[model samples]
Target: MARLLVTPATGALPVTAGGMTLSLTDPGCITSLAPWRGAGMALSKALRAAHGVDFPDPGRISTSGTTRCLWAGRDQAFLVGPAPDSAALADHAALTDQSDAWAVMRLDGPGARDVLARLTPLDLRAQVFEPGHTARTLLGQMNAVLSRDAANGYEIMVFRSMTATALHELTEAMKSVTAQGGADPSPG
Candidate 1:
């Protein structure tokens, strides 16, 4: 007998418009961590020992090798990386398995920022939202975690239940931006 493996069934979604590419991202093993009773220092040290990642400050992200800790909000950080382990954070703080609860995507290439600018309220510019910066913002009607992965790359995470709607809105926005840039219109 063999165990089973099931994915979210989102299939492979990659949209190319002009010089931009929007691709569904595979975020392996996402874990949410929230400290209780102001034990952030203790929790941070524990996480450092477990994943070699320094807990990030608010609006910031800390990455050590493959592991990344994104600031989810005040006193809370989302540990997005490989090798998911509940006990890695359970003792130090509250833990939630968010691996299947999010629909992650990346917008990269030349016109990535232009597409993002059309959908999100936050400034997606280089100086203001540079790499290592993270924020919770509105992506159309859905709440999304927006992170600047690089000057030309950005990551967006929205609730799994809102995946279709979010993708639709993002694709549409990308099309508009790319079309104006004289790139071929995105696929319908």
Candidate 2:
């Protein structure tokens, strides 16, 4: 039998143009952690002890080192960037491996928000969606988890099957922003 090789959801190389760069990112192990009903506080404590990150509240992203707990929905968060100690977290939340179910991409540059503004309806203005904030929103027509990881950087997660579409939309937006001389209207 021929061996099957694993490939990244998108290509491994970054696509860059006019100072904006979009690159596929490996966020280590991605675990979906849903706290048992009424176990939210306990889960947050246990997570902080085990991973040094709090189970985030809605629209937040908690971080400690490279590990992050991103609020994924009303009662769920994604434990990303390290292999979670399942034994430590199993008691408080339902832990499911989501390592291969999604594609992770990083968009960074001065024109990043401008590019994103062209694609998403959500306000990317720094005052409204500052660094460390996250949202479950539409990226073009696809559902995506968008996080502002830095002043001019974002991490976008989408279903693995939508990788190409996401890339195409983002690339087109980036091109348009670049063509417009990188004008950004969102206040810092």
Model 1: lDDT to the true structure: 0.79
Lowest summed lDDT across 10 adjacent residues in model 2 is found at 1-10
C-alpha local distance difference test of each model = 0.79, 0.88
Which candidate has the highest TM-score of all? 2
For model 2, name the residue pairs that clash.
Answer: none
Give the top-scoring candidate (lDDT).
Answer: 2
- Per-residue lDDT tens digits of candidate 1, residues 1-188? 12122234345478777777778877777888888777788889888888888779888998988789999987888888775466766767888778877888888877777777777899766778888899999998789999998877899999888877877887888778777864233321
Q: What is the lDDT for 61 in model 2?
A: 92
- Native RMSD of candidate 1 (Å): 4.6
Position 163, candidate 2: lDDT = 86
Candidate 2, 134: how far from true, in Å? 0.8
